[model samples]
Target: MFELIGIPPQALFGQLLLGLINGSFYALLSLGLAVIFGMLNVINFAHGALYMLGAFVAWFLLQYLGLGYWWALVLSPVAVGAVGIVIEKTMLQRLYKLDHLYGLLFTFGLALILEGIFKHFYGVSGQSYTTPDLFKGGTNLGFMFLPYYRGWVVVLSIAVCAATWYAIEKTRLGSYLRAATENPRLVQSFGINVPVMITLTYGFGVALAGLAGVMAAPIYSVNPLMGSNLIIVVFAVVVIGGMGSIFGAVVSGYLLGLLEGLTKVFMPEAANIVVFVIMVVVLLLRPAGLFGRER
Candidate 1:
């Protein structure tokens, strides 16, 4: 019953939770995009379509093979990553040396194709995935009742984000990726297959998108159009975070999510515009993004 700026703590915290959950999706999806753009120089507009594909992949497994969430966790990313590999080889590889805009356009077209196909079959009515048995309960936290699944989402998302950050920021392979992006010729001279490196990097990024799709399967209604709608907001997050900085994407994604949550409690009308407002402010303050250097 405690009042927080004229709103109850329950309302505030609930909004906060919603914001964090949405932010998790933003972080995961944007991180993948940031990686591809920064390192591979590919503007992957098809990412959201690929994310939708991941969710569908999970649904397919459940329906036809009787696979559970646990199995989908391991399998969906692999499946999607394989598809990414095909895309890179068939289409994206040809555009590496051309204008970056071409990459964006090609991928955009690909997104439309994918969305069109799914829309044709599924018709966008939305499908649901039930939470697993282990994650279906709620916990009384003394102040409020917290659903186990929501908590699991928050905790697992943080862990995945952290692990991804560590892998790219702290490891040797990450060093090569950074180096290769800055100077592919130099990295190739060092005997690393730079082309393969680019392909794998793109795949890994797509795999991250797949992981997000699987994670989101149970929480949000599965629908063909889900990724398309969320992708725009995520793009705004990328712009705010700086497309070149992975950590920036992750941190800003979560921060904005929390900010959106706070807005929902005190000024519901402001929730949708708050992120863009912040993005505009950030751009005015630092045109290169919060963590990026001006080019």
Candidate 2:
């Protein structure tokens, strides 16, 4: 078999597939961050905790309510999203007039509180979530074996990302959202409810995180720390992609994921820091990010 850089094709393909899967999660989470920051102007440090909540909610549904994977996929996001609505109305809405640091600090404290509560009740140990029977096997793809669930994750994530991009970039509602972000007072003068829109936008961004949590539950050990571990990487992605640039967030997410995967194969010792390294380089070269428009 032909080899690239002395690595076997199987190993290379396997790592690439793994990278793509990781990238999907990054894209989803960062997309949410971008959306929230764009319209609500909040950093949403509690996003990771909300993601953890989504996974726990799914587990609870199955454990106590006799629901299954499919049900969790549909309900978890909605439940978590409702929680987001409450948080926005009662807590986040009050911080809009202050410096952005206030929003960041508030959400950071919220994240800590949420994680602490979960740790108190569930402990630090991870819980297992079974893959649905529908995605129970793997298919041979010449060089590597692709698990059905992983493939589903990749496909579904791409579909969701694409759909979100279209909705925000190409639709009339999206135009209104963009306009509101640019000038809430002007939009409000037109009789549009800007405050409610801000609230809903925050909820929607968090719902994306909840959706990703459901997708991740079957693959990762569902734990309080899972989202926290991934969230930092996602924040790096958002920074590299540009704070409020939707397209930048999605593209840079997958790009960095693949870069990280390649680094693992080439320089295993640097795998963890590769994404940040690239982020530093990108910032030096184009501070506005690859897809971000300069203000």
TM-score of each: 0.96, 0.97
Residue-wise lDDT of candidate 2 within 1-295, one digit each (tens)? Answer: 4365788878888888889988999999999999999888899999999999999999999999989999999899999899999999998999999999999999999999999999989988888999999999999998788999999999999999999999999998898899999999999999999889888899999999999999999999889998899889999999899889999999988988888888898899998898888889988999987777777
- RMSD after CA superposition, every candidate: 1.6, 1.4
lDDT of 2 at 88: 97
Model 2 spans > 4 angstroms off: 1-4
- Model 1 over residues 167-200: C-alpha lDDT tens digits? 8889999899999999999999999998998999
Say which candidate scores most in lDDT: 2
TM-score winner among the candidates? 2
- Native-vs-model 2 lDDT? 0.91
